[model samples]
Target: MAADPTHRAIEAVFRIERARLIATLARMTRDVDRAEELAQEALLSALTEWPKSGVPDRPGAWLTAAAKRRLIDGARHQSMLERKHAEIARERDAETDMSAEAIEAARDDPLGDELLGLIFAACHPVVSPEARAALTLRLVGGLTVEEIARAFLSSEAAIAARITRAKKAIAKAGVAFEVPRGAELRARLGSVLEVVYLIFNEGYAATAGPSLVRPPLCAEAQRLARILAGLMPEQPEVVGLLALVEIQASRLAARADVDGRFVPLTEQNRARWDQLLIRRGLNALDRAEALGGTDGAYVLQAALAACHARARSAESTDWARISALYDRLAEVVPSPVVELNRAVAHSMAFGPEAGLRLVDDIANAALLRNYAPLPAARGDFLFRAGRTGEARAEFEAAAALAANERERDFLLARAAACAP
Candidate 1:
């Protein structure tokens, strides 16, 4: 069935401006749930009116204003203080004729502290790390429960519950909606970085989408990381994160062809990579290292990415160095995902057999039961070893498990190539 054009337009606007809307609302309401509710109500308004009114030229601002008015109306119904109501009313009235240019200009302003404050609040240590990731994407990344669940390979119900508890936990702990300081700042920063990286990764390889990558989301996360680096110039992790995102984003241009076909790393036209972004990433990596973050998780990952960025082509890649970096990265942040990456690295550096041993170990783990990458990696190793039949089966399994349509198609093509 065809999706409603108006619905798609509304969803697109929400995706692009969600962070701004939530940040602005959170700043005004200081209550996570209320801010989300206000935004949801505005979204409802868009759904009902946009089809008939013809989508607004400044839809984001239109939605923002609608949400703000709703906030003010709620305050009025509750008989809130006149000073508060008057202040909000004056602010809303000033933008009676909102223009798209005005909306873009206002949102373009340097990562104002309000968005950063909302991020800090989302990363409060009171909630679990899983909850932190979910809440950060929900409140800051503006991802829906279903989107978040697909990204995490969890059920939508679980993700929704986690978001609910996270908001309540933040309120219960009385966590302030401002960036922290000194020890508190250092403690919470890691979680925030983790969440931003997760958002970026999802954009880099969308979990469930027609395209393998979502450039807007990637640009959004990159913008946030760039903003964060500016906010905390001396923080090694922040600099490292900026480096990692910039480096990965450099390849975005080369990931697909003019015909929208997926291009493997070995087949990509290296000349298409963004040199400016690569240089910016390398500079940030240098700064991270200078700040004594050689052992940091993000720094390690950025260094690994640098190895690829430094190579002019796939044949010139320093797989040995990348393998070593992955080994250290595994220790810094032990997870099934890291292990899988290391196995791939080992295969490239050593031999397919050496990598396959590690791959099989990860394949049997219950955690990766539905993970597409596991079978995909195993398929590559089998193909390298000349086991055509086995490789075809693995590739077919990977294609089935893959959530992104592009990725699934790519895998299926590989499976077809293995035929007799």
Candidate 2:
């Protein structure tokens, strides 16, 4: 069934402008919860009004103005009920002027990056890492709780509770709703970048969904990365993170086929990759290295992506260099996941047997016990080594543990291929 064109247009406008709207209101109200409610009211207003009247030429500004009016009306009602009515009445005119001026300033001034402030607020150190990502997706990415849950492969109720707890943590900590400066900014950046990359990874390979990729979520993450780059041009890690996302996004179009089957990087047609994004990524990588970010975690990962981007064919790729880069990445940010990836790289550069040995070493790591990728990588090595029986069992195990439908299907097909 075809969706209503009008509704689709409205939805697109809301998705693009939602962060800005929430940020602007948050700045004025100094209350994230209240700001979100006002933003929702503005959206409801748009749904009711835009259909009757044509969509406004400046929809963002229109939404902002609508939310502003709601804020004013709420203040007016509160003033009427309070014993301090006289005090509130005296300040009403000044409050109205300030709200308009701030909204306008946010639109014109580069320094008034409200969305960045909102992101910093969501990524406050007080929030748990898992909850930080969930809250950021809700407030900055404008993803619904259900969408966030699917992306994280968690139950909707759990995601909701995490978001609730995160908001309370922020309020309890009395975190200011503004971007930090100097040392404070540096301290907060790591958390912000981690959450942004987490968002991009979910979009790169949806954790649990019918679709293999979620382009809108990927775009949102990239938008946030680009915002960070603009605000901190001198931060090498920031630039490197931007480069990493750009390079990864270039392969998005080729990640799936006409029938929506997952296509491995080595199997994808190189010509289908976005050349513009590849160039952008490579340029950003060069800038990061020039700024003395050669050994940063993000810089190392960008270098690894660059190795693939530079290759005309998978066979021509410098697997030796890639394995070396993975070695550095593991040292910089050790994890069971990195070990699993390093094993794959070792297999590519050396042999299936070499990779299999590495995988076996980490096979008992607690984190990899139920991680589908662990068995999936093992299955690939076994298949390449002509151990069909073992390969099939590993693939089947991976499929059983998989959360995403598309990924499960791909693994099951691999298992079938290992049959006699």
Candidate 3:
């Protein structure tokens, strides 16, 4: 049976409000797991009540209030500490008694600090770095375990266990659930940025879905980047990350066709790209350079993206400059993935032979063994070099490894095109 419209609306509201609600509840409960449960309880309450009486004018506030009341009740029943119970009761009563207009205004509040704190907490050093990304996506990006699993190419069970362990580790370590300051902020910022970038990359090209793009996920990551930039205006890397996502997001419109077919960056219509985002990204990039973040990993990546943004057409792209930026990026943050990308840039700047040689050098790297993009990129170079048989084989291998349906289809089509 089709889901009721009311229920669908409630689901949509919950998905949008979930991260904020959990952040607020985490503040109140001082326990991430409890906060999540409380948020779910609020969602269940909304599903039950919203249909009975039309949805509230401010559903987010209504959900927050519901969660707060549940918190108060749970505290009253479980905590023998009168001080805790009284504190919970007072907070609940204060918010629940607010005038509708005041409640609306409160809801309109930026969620700047609260959400940022939750993000930092989720990415705390106490959690394993991989787990940190998964947890941050869950708590701050409002992604589900299944979605996160797909993003990471892991099983749902593994992702769930990783998140559970991360929460437990944070609780046991008594990690502060507040944004760090001074040197501590700088120390913690890298992990936080890593998580945000992971979220954006997943949305930019989803790992396992019918659709090539997940707009909501991309928007959430972009919003998080902007929030981080605001909270740490002096941090050049943070600003660079904001710039990177802005420039990359500008291409979302042209990344796919009206029929939802994948469009390679070189083939995407430049006019469809959002000029406003490109301008914002360039302005932010200038700010990063002014702040002396010219060599930062994100800044280098942003510069690479800027190369494309500045190009009037694919033929006009400064591939040589992009290759140089990727060289600098690899120096700042060396990895097989960076090498693979660098190869592509070298090919564009030089020739298919140059790129193919680079790809062959890393073909044996364990990290790229099952990574579809490795073979897929190599296939492109080989095809351009007129090695159609080898290119077809590589494309088939990439298609076999692809998890996203759309990406797999694109790879298979490339394989077919290479047939004699």
Candidate closest to the true structure, highest TM-score: 2
* Candidate 1 residue lDDT tens string, 246-342: 9999999899877666788778898999999999999999999999998899999999989989999899999999999999999999888899999
Per the 3 Å backbone cut-off, how many clashing residue pairs does candidate 1 have? 0
**What value of lDDT does candidate 1 attain over all alpha carbons?**
0.84
Question: What ordering of candidates by lDDT runs from best to worst?
Answer: 2, 3, 1
Clashes within 3 Å, all models in order: 0, 0, 0
Model 2 vs truth, CA RMSD = 4.2
* Local accuracy of candidate 3 as per-residue lDDT tens digits, 121-179: 99988888789878987887777888888766689999999999999999898876677
Q: What would the per-residue lDDT of candidate 2 be over residues 1-420, giving only the tens digit for each residue?
A: 119888778978987889878988877767788889999898889888999997877788778878877776777677767645345456657756544345565576466467788889999989988899899989987889998887776899999999999988988888877889889998998889998898898889888778899887788789889988887788999999999999999999999999888999999999999999999999999999999999999989999999999999999999999999999999999988999999999999999998999899899999999899999999999999999999999999999999988889999999999966
Q: Please state the error at residue 27 of candidate 3 in Å.
A: 4.2
Give per-model CA RMSD: 7.5, 4.2, 5.0
lDDT by candidate, in order shown? 0.84, 0.88, 0.87
TM-score of each: 0.70, 0.81, 0.77
Q: Least accurate stretch of 10 residues (summed lDDT) in model 2?
A: 97-106
**Global local distance difference test of model 3:** 0.87
TM-score of 2: 0.81
State the weakest 10-residue window (summed lDDT) of model 1: 103-112
